[model samples]
Target: MKANPKAKADPKADAAAAPAGSKKKLMIAALAAVLLLGGGGGAAWFFMQGGDAAAEDTPKASKKKKKASNVKPHYVPVEAFTVNLQPENGEQYLQVQFTLQVDGPEQATLIKDNMAIVRNRVLLLLSGKKASEISTVEGKQQLAAEIQAIVQEPFAKGGDEQDVTDVLFTSFIIQ
Candidate 1:
């Protein structure tokens, strides 16, 4: 016996199966896209935000520590004394006493060793100045800076291991 040329078709069942399979494939593809995008965004955020924050944070921390380090004193029992300048050009005499603070023993030794040379140089510098140079606050500050530089240069050059902290005019009498 020969089979029939047209068999009866079950349209409803085939149609249902086709739609369900397509729906499942669509859901899987959407899930994969979401995961890929989320992972990539998270990785980019980690690199961009975290790197700069770490870089900026380290310097701020070190700068704060450095500020504290500067607050610590390296020397005590500061030296103070008077030095008379050589008279010049018929101007009145200048007498100045300096209170100096230094950072270490080597610096103290260098200062002691070079005291006379320092004094002589200071006297010379003072004598060269007009009375007006010592008369104003700005001028006096400049003079202090000059004296500090003069006193420190030799010690620095002599390889003393520390710095001269400051030179203060404890007293001044210009007559």
Candidate 2:
């Protein structure tokens, strides 16, 4: 059983017999490197596609915005109306000022031309409301909407209809 002292230690054999912790650390480092490279490649691919897609969509979006910007709003003022409201406990009254929002100047002109009929309809609607009915915010909003709908209707037979976008109550008072 004599030991051979001249035998050289093989490096490959030493590495194969490395401790479990050392092997685990090496494997972890290699896995981390692979994952980092894979993640970077995936991110690069995604950004390249996203950039190209955004570039392609930009012109169409800009054209739509330009078209939307061409449409303008027109506002027409209406004279104040003081109507005797429906009596609740006593005589009630409502004084309201109106401004009509139209799609364009032409629509505003049409509304102004038919202002008498519009005023008559609005006065009738207002006179029918009780003081309590027009006191709340919701009631006022509903009244505005109703007025808008009525004002938008055609005033005469074979007449072009006016587009009343909204009825704004500049002043609303209930007594």
Candidate 3:
């Protein structure tokens, strides 16, 4: 290579060229920093959310199992009968047949002995209820409880104190 002594190499232009390479390197470094921060932040957030969700779900899962284990077995015996009653004003009224499953033999005996009173009380309660209330599911449930109370009241008075577990409606018709 031959050196040309007359050629002027401008130092300021060389400085400007150096700055352009440094600017490209700087831009690449900035982009790398941004990507690293975004990727790390997203990963950290994903792990934190997963951890919190697991923690929240654990107690609920345990409680559900506990509740299922603690549940008491429901016992109800079955009996069925239809009765006619003279309501207020001595009107002849028809009642849908009802079946009950008493808890024990003793309770069943007591119910059988006092069938007349139980029937009368049930008829009275059903007579007073509006047609809509007695026909609905909730109303029928309420009626069953009322009958249980009435049947149990006499037994409680007689000192048996045994529970009639449930009243089942084998047949129900209102006339």
TM-score of each: 0.49, 0.61, 0.44
lDDT ranking of the models: 2, 1, 3
How accurate locally, in lDDT, is each candidate? 0.67, 0.83, 0.65
- Give lDDT: candidate 1, residue 119: 69
Give the local distance difference test score of model 1: 0.67
Give lDDT tens digits, candidate 1, residues 26-55: 999999999999999988998876445555
Q: Which wins on TM-score, candidate 1 or candidate 2?
A: 2
lDDT of candidate 3 over 90-153, digit per residue (tens): 4444456666656455556666777677667766766566545566899789978887777666
Global lDDT of model 2: 0.83
Instruction: List where candidate 3 sits over 4 angstroms from the true fold.
Output: 1-94, 155-158
Model 2 ranges with Cα > 4 A deviation: 1-70
Model 3 weakest lDDT span, ten residues long: 73-82
lDDT (tens digit, per residue) of candidate 2 on 1-175: 7767898788888878787669899999999999999999998998876545565456666753443345587999999999998888888778899899887777888888888999999988888888887799999888989898888778888876677777888998877
